[model samples]
Target: MKVAIYTLGCKVNQYETQAMEQELRRRGHQVVAFEEAADVYVVNSCSVTAVSDRKSRQMLYRVRREHPQAVLALCGCYSQTHPEDVEKLDVDLIAGTGDRSGFLDLLEQAAAERRHIVALDRSFDHRTFEVLPAGGLESRTRCLLKVEDGCVNFCSYCIIPYARGPVRSLPLDKAAEQAAGLKAAGYREIVLTGIEISSWGQDLKDGKSLIDLLETVAAAAPGVRLRLGSLEPRTVTEDFCRRAAALPDLCPQFHLSLQSGCDETLRRMNRKYDTARYLQSVELLNRFFDRPAVTTDLITGFPEETEAEFEQTLAFIRACGFARMHIFPYSIRPGTPAAKMRQVPKSVKEERAHRAAAVAAELRKNYLEGCVGATYPVLFEQPKEDWFFGHAPNYAEVLVKGTDLHNEIRPVTITSTDGEFLYGTIKE
Candidate 1:
């Protein structure tokens, strides 16, 4: 059968979709793009916000309309949260966030019977981690390895905890084995991704933490660089940074999750850490790893966020000097606490997002400037037109004009900047 998979939202979702594609291919199915004619269409979706929900529905409807004869499959966070919403689309198969192996089986059954199938289990009943083989179809420079799944953090603004269910971890031995396998598959880098990596090991009765998992994976793939996904700020500490810095393969980029920078807004959002603690985490990472790229995500104009609070957030971001930042105007997710609270005007949210974005752009420019005249070991991913694109150990995208640089790690002399990316030449 020819299959087309459409992935929406988060690296974890992407990783799952990649796993699904691998499984389908192992069963002798040809995987292609959604627009191309195919026997099946899989829409792996998200419900992080109402907008995300809308997008998921739109994608499902479009796929159904375009290929009316093809079997339509819907799964992931959106389906997990609202199975009925997805079923309303007249999809052939509906599987929730869990049970990938079972989902694939159901897809096969749908193909055999040519009928609708809905396979959804109570998300909170989920306890076991569904392990899937890592790596993409084509040999790529970077592969994502999901070390953990589900979130226990009930942040007031998030619906993920409900959609993802209780924390479930991949055993340390399995993670090590997957890392070795991915490295052997010719991946130059492995991004340790998850829905909430910080909550890793909580499911285990044995006292293990993310640091322990990182130690094992890093040791397993000493030759391949290991990058991390977004982390809870509260997880970073002097001890954590000290141990993580000792790992030679760990990338020097850290993305801490900071929804709001003001203590009052954080309180409203029910974030685990305050602005001061988040700053401490940033400081600790910088102190341990020389010139590490500290990145973060910020939500501007949260419910009832005053002008004074927004200024505090901008000031806080400027103080941190993030190498990269993703700024978003907070979107109200239905059923979340903040949704029913006093909502910020759309104009105010947009204004605050612009203000935060300007500061972030300035800081990023300065960070790139700091890379000038420095030599970095970059893992070349692919070549585009006249320039070859790759990432520094700090995960900064490095562009250089050269030929035959794919999958090679070489020292590149940073010489110029194109405002966003650093342009350099590989030192022969």
Candidate 2:
């Protein structure tokens, strides 16, 4: 059978989809592009918000409409949380967030019998971590190694805690082995990604933490650069910074998750940390890594958030000086606690999003401009038109007019900026 996999949501989802593709290929099935004619269409869905759910439905329906003969497989967060909704879709196989191997088995069975199958587990009931292989089909500059799974942080606005279960980690030795294997496979960079990487060693009694995972992975990949996924603000401690800084391969970009900056809004959102704690984490990253690019996520117009509170958020983000920030207007998810609170007006959410976006743009531009005159070891990913696009250690996009720079790390000296990316020249 020919399989076409479409993934939605975070890097973990992408990694899992790649794992699925690998599994199918191992079973002697062809893995084709989604646009190509195929026997199966697997939509690894996301349900971060109402918008995400709608998008997941739209993608699945489009596949069903376009290729009626192909089997439709709906899985991931959307199918995990709202199985009934997914069952209503013209899907042949319905699998939840876990049980990838079982999902593949069911997919084969569904293909053979042309019958519908539902494979969902009580997400939180299973404490054992599901191990899936990392890396993908094509040889790429960066690969995501999911070292952790699930989140315990039941934030007011998130459905992920339910969609993904309690914290389960890939043990330290296993993580090191995976990293070594990915490095052996010729991947230049390995991104340690997960639902909540900060909560990584909580389920284990080995006294290992996120830093231990980082250090272990770093040591595993002798020459490969290591990048981290989004981190909870609470994870960036002085100890973490101090230890992580010593690892030469770790990238300097840190994405701290800060939904809303205002203390009152944070309390309402049930965030574990306030602006002060978030700032402390940001400061520690800066203190340890030289000119580290600190990025963050922000939600505007949260439930019952006053304009003054929004302003406080704006002021707090400006103070953080994030290199890049993703700001989204609040979207209510049905099962989350924030959805039950007095909702903020859509107009207010839109307005605040725009305002915050403007500030974020300015900060981004400044960060790019600040890169001028700096020489960085950039891992060149691909070349397009007149330039080869790559990323510096801080995850800054560095573009150079060059030929065949793919998968090559070169010394790039940033000489100019176009307000979006830094144009640089590769030093011979």
Clashes of each: 0, 0
Q: TM-scores of the models, in the given order?
A: 0.98, 0.98
> Each candidate: what lDDT?
0.91, 0.91
The segments of candidate 1 whose C-alpha lies over 4 angstroms from its true place after superposition are: none
lDDT of 1 by residue, 1-428 (tens): 99899999999999999999999889988999877999999999999999999999999889878888989999999988887677778798998999898999999999989998888889999999999989986558899999889998888899998899999999999999999998888888999999999989999979999999999999998889999899999899898999999998889999999988899999999888998999999999989998999999999989999999988988999999999999899899988898988999999999999989999999999999999999999999889788999999988889998878889999999998866989999998
Q: Which residue ranges in model 2 land beyond 4 Å of their true spot?
A: none
Q: For candidate 2, lDDT tens digit of each residue in 270-362?
A: 889888999999889888999999998999989999989888988898899999999999999999999999998899899999999999999
What's the distance in Å from true for residue 367, model 1? 0.8
lDDT of 1: 0.91
Q: Which run of 10 residues does model 2 get worst, by summed lDDT?
A: 133-142
